[model samples]
Target: MPQIVCPACGAINRIPPGKPAETARCGKCREPLFQGRPADLDGAGLARHITRDSIPLVVDFWADWCGPCKMMAPEFVKAAQALEPLVRFAKLDTEAAPEAAAAHGIRSIPTMMVFRNGREVARQSGAMPAGQIVQWLRDAVLALGS
Candidate 1:
């Protein structure tokens, strides 16, 4: 089992790999937490959480009005479902979390940033299908050796 800090309600959830979708519940809000997108994070939390978490984080920086962002949402969700045990996925709405967007220097919607040990390893901007997203994760994880 692994502990996943829920971005939805800021609850630290202990989730087993076998039942991530079932076991994932926010400790605070009791909300069903694991949604297949980047977690919206603020300045300090984003810096600390990404750096401290053991697993790789795939963050999707997006906005509600962006067409490409909407187009990639489903693909992101699918990718999160397939890669649950191995990767921690989150979605950040730039409009909602402005400070986080600014700290990350996000200039566009649909920008995906892969982080390990709080350090950015890879980033890409644009819409990618589930296959490509999975492939990118595979390569990124392999490159990180974890």
Candidate 2:
């Protein structure tokens, strides 16, 4: 079983393979931590979670108003569903996490950042299909030789 540290509320959640997202809960906040998709994160929390955790991270910076962003949302969710134990996926709404977006120098919506061992390894901007997203994630992991 692998663990997913919640970026939103800082709950270290142990998520076993095949575990239904409906049952996943945060130990600290006792909130519905896993929503069968990437957990949205803010600036500080996003930094903390990415640095503290050992697993690779994929972050999507998006906003509600962006049309391309909305198109990418489902693909992100699907990627999250397929890439358990290998990668951790998260989302940050630029509207809500403006500081984070600025800190990361996210000039556009649907920006994807891939981090490994607390360092950013790759970044891409624009909307992509599910297969392409998965390939990009695998490429990032392969680059790390992990």
In model 2, where do residues sit more than 4 Å from their true spots? Answer: 1-4, 12-35
Top-lDDT candidate index: 2
lDDT of 2 at 24: 69
Per-model TM-score on C-alpha atoms: 0.77, 0.80
lDDT of 1 by residue, 1-146 (tens): 55566666565667566774545677688876666555666655566558656678888988899999999999998998888646778788888888898888898888999888768889999999998999999987856665
In candidate 1 the C-alpha lDDT for residue 47 amounts to 63
What TM-score does structure 1 among the candidates reach?
A: 0.77
Give the alpha carbon lDDT tens digit for every residue of 9-82 in model 2.
Answer: 78667767787745667777877655557877788779877876667888999999999999999999998888
lDDT of candidates 1 onward, in order? 0.77, 0.80
Q: How close is candidate 2 to the true structure, as a TM-score?
A: 0.80
Q: Identify the candidate with maximal TM-score.
A: 2
Estimate the overall C-alpha local distance difference test score of candidate 1. Answer: 0.77
Measured with C-alpha atoms, the lDDT of residue 80 in candidate 2 is 81
